[model samples]
Target: MSDERTETVGRSGRLTMRDIARLANVSMPTVSRVLNDSPLVTVETRTRVLEVAQAHGYAVNRNAKKLRQARTGTVAVMLDFASHRHGAIGDPFIFELLAGVSEALSIRNQELLLSPPGLDDTRAFEDFHRARGADGFIILGQGTRDAMLRSLARRGIPMVVWGAVSKDAGYCAVGSDNLLGGRLAGEYFRMRGRRRWLFLGDIRHAELRLRYEGLCQEAAEDKEVTVEYLPIASMAFNATGQTVSAYLAGGAQPDALFAFSDTAAMAAIGAFRERGLIAPDDYSLVGYNNIPPAANFSPALTTIDQKTDVAGALLVEKLMQHIDGGRARSILLPTQMVVRET
Candidate 1:
């Protein structure tokens, strides 16, 4: 960008970075490089830029300084879900994930930047890169952005995703063993003398699909056990309630229930109550991602812990490796069941 425009843009009798650039007869970026102490600026140019700034009593904006350094000391967390469709954007899982990521970043004096949920991957990543908003990114899911992510990776963008690990993904990923989590829920139900099982969550997601496969594999071992899959048509509580109500209305009955998330589990429970059924009495229940309020539910949720703490730490560590120009490997942390009243 040209610095000559400073004379026209600057406020009367006040000095801006643009004015300093104009005085030093250099590009605005050169002045920024000098202020940020980047080695890219020649010693003579740096001296001229500093002299102009000192003569004009101009102060640098902290954010501008960081941008010039090319390392914002910030990591952007992008949610790759259709929040409007799910209506679960504010779900406990999102908040818990943010908390874990924030805590981990804070430990290293890095900041967290939350991108708007459901943003178009290509556009979002391009804008973030052009603005230099963050040093790297941690994508929450692989949704429909796999192709875009792969494309970006081919161009050397630093990123880490949280979801199923796949050889074709071509991007660093960190997530819990979703297959093992599903198996644990199934094994626990079978041990409790339950036969019929209903699996919840949208299987279109790569992670949920893997979990569904594992659950079915475990159910196959027991001839008497039957497993049915149900995709959550919507993420609204009432939507889940409506689905449960319809299932009950059709004379369908499952002895065990496994909702992919605690929010869905709670919604299912509410639907059961409307039909005069209680959990662990009429049917056993299991949820995934043991968020904080899971223990306070009426029946206290029996859910699987996705280990958000470890996921968060691994995401940050992996992104750092990529930022330092090193290859980052995917990780699959083990999941464990946290048994409660249900």
Candidate 2:
């Protein structure tokens, strides 16, 4: 956080409020205190700020020599702004993550500035990262290598995502082994005396592919179990009613079924009821991401506990490390099975 290597954006080497905040990235008010040489800033924080400012080649504006610094003790959690048409398909999971994110920010005596879902180019997400009020961002339901990810990298803002395709890229990511969750699904059914399994959900997503691959591998060992691939949902993975009914209409009654998401599993169960069939008896089932609604369904769903709250906490830790000039990478949390009646 030294300022000796600093590069100001404009001539005269004057720093803007936003620029100063970005330098601190972890918190704006902290940076403002440092700039003002106020007693409010701890010696440790003041030292870090001076180093960052000096490195950025910042020169105080002699004209406005005594301007009060800008610092708004707040951080942000990035929403998958694109997926808000139905009031957040992932709202429950998001709420749980926020609870944890807030708990962490509170330890620093800071608050979170929430950004609503919006429609814009990648710049929208980039704006979230550059906000003067927020310390940085904790992105949920999205991954790195996304358009926003690339833009944030260019801005050098402290950032982290719930998940990412690669762990070793520049940004921070925290997610579970989705493939391992899938393997667990296959293993669960194998022990239940059920074979002829069908997998459903968006096949295009890398998460789904990983889960499917694991399921396939586990199902292979059991000659009595036949795992079938059923890419039911297309553009909208949530559109599951008709999709599930299609396979049912084809006269295929797989003894077991695994879905990529809890919603998909609910849809599958709904289809069974319409056909006068009972779950666990007629067809054993399993779903991933132990989402809230999954447990409340008529037949409580068996699923994979994704530990999304843990992922959120890990994400903030990663961003903090990167802000400290440490190496950034992905952190994988563990997953487990939540076996319920259905």
Candidate 3:
């Protein structure tokens, strides 16, 4: 390829503050200040420098730029890859939080790099800060005592944990009032004359802990009601079927159920059907995070609307403001209940 054309194809391969300054007829420091959006440069000087640099097709290498100035103009987002890719991502609660982040980032011309989740290497945070200068991070899903996060915290990695992170100052969090969610579930069941209730899904997920807490709090007010918590970890369709059989055979059938999530609600509903029972007919039921499929279900579902789209947008907004000279802050969006057939 021709040198000129090749350089155009690889702007990241060639451009630097030095080159920009050289073309703009300014000192390297002057160009550097403008690149960092420093107000020290007068408007005339800043405009002239920028025009010259742009005319010459100068571009900033994020890595090199960050190394020089300690910022990549980037924010990292960690998501539950397993859930997001599986079409199970949106539940009202999770959706709203993510929307808030995404909207905030978009206005500031920033992006969310949804880091894949896994049980693999946990030292990724250390490597991230070592090479690239990331100003901060936004953790989206359920990751606990992560090595990367801990190392980053030990080194003072600025971050906002949506529902992750300990309540330590090292981590800032924006999470739903899970206790409220649980209470709402319990209230819904109690009002419907359900005294014996069942709960489904793993209690290990961080969010579930909050949901369960909320339900217990509300159910405690009612003396006659009892809430049973069940774990289905590592259990598949057939195994879950057998587990459900035991519940029926043992005569511990619940008058109502409040699942930790919509998926779990569906799973429970399926289990109920397997035993020739109908939800909200033979027994009342309520679910959380009225996801799209919740409405499409055979009897639909009664649940909470956590507003994920708004949350995702808000997350983006927060990232953008922080990138553009804003200080860190925590935000909480409200939740509402959505009543349907079930």
What is the per-residue lDDT of model 2 for residues 79-118, given as tens digits with 9 covering 90 to 100? Answer: 6544433444443666777788878878766667676556
Best by TM-score: 1
Instruction: Tell how far residue 159 is off in model 1, in angstroms.
Output: 0.9
Question: Can you give the lDDT of residue 148 in candidate 2?
Answer: 54
Error of 2 at 287 (Å): 1.5
Least well predicted 10-residue stretch by lDDT in candidate 1: 2-11
* Candidate rank order under lDDT: 1, 2, 3
**Per-residue alpha-carbon lDDT of model 1 for 1-342, expressed as tens digits?**
744434453668778777877778899988877876789988999988887777667777778668557688888898754632544475678777777788889998898888844447677676766678778888887765678888888777899998888877788988888898889988999999999999987888888888888889889989999999887776666777788878877887888999978888998998888888899899999998899899999999999998886777888889999999999999888789999988
The Cα local distance difference test for each model comes to 0.82, 0.71, 0.66
Backbone clashes for every candidate come to: 0, 9, 34
Shift in Å, residue 29, candidate 2: 15
Q: Which candidate, 1 or 3, has the higher lDDT? A: 1
What TM-score would each prediction reach against the true structure?
0.79, 0.69, 0.71
Clash list (residue pairs), candidate 1? none
Candidate 1 TM-score, true structure as reference? 0.79
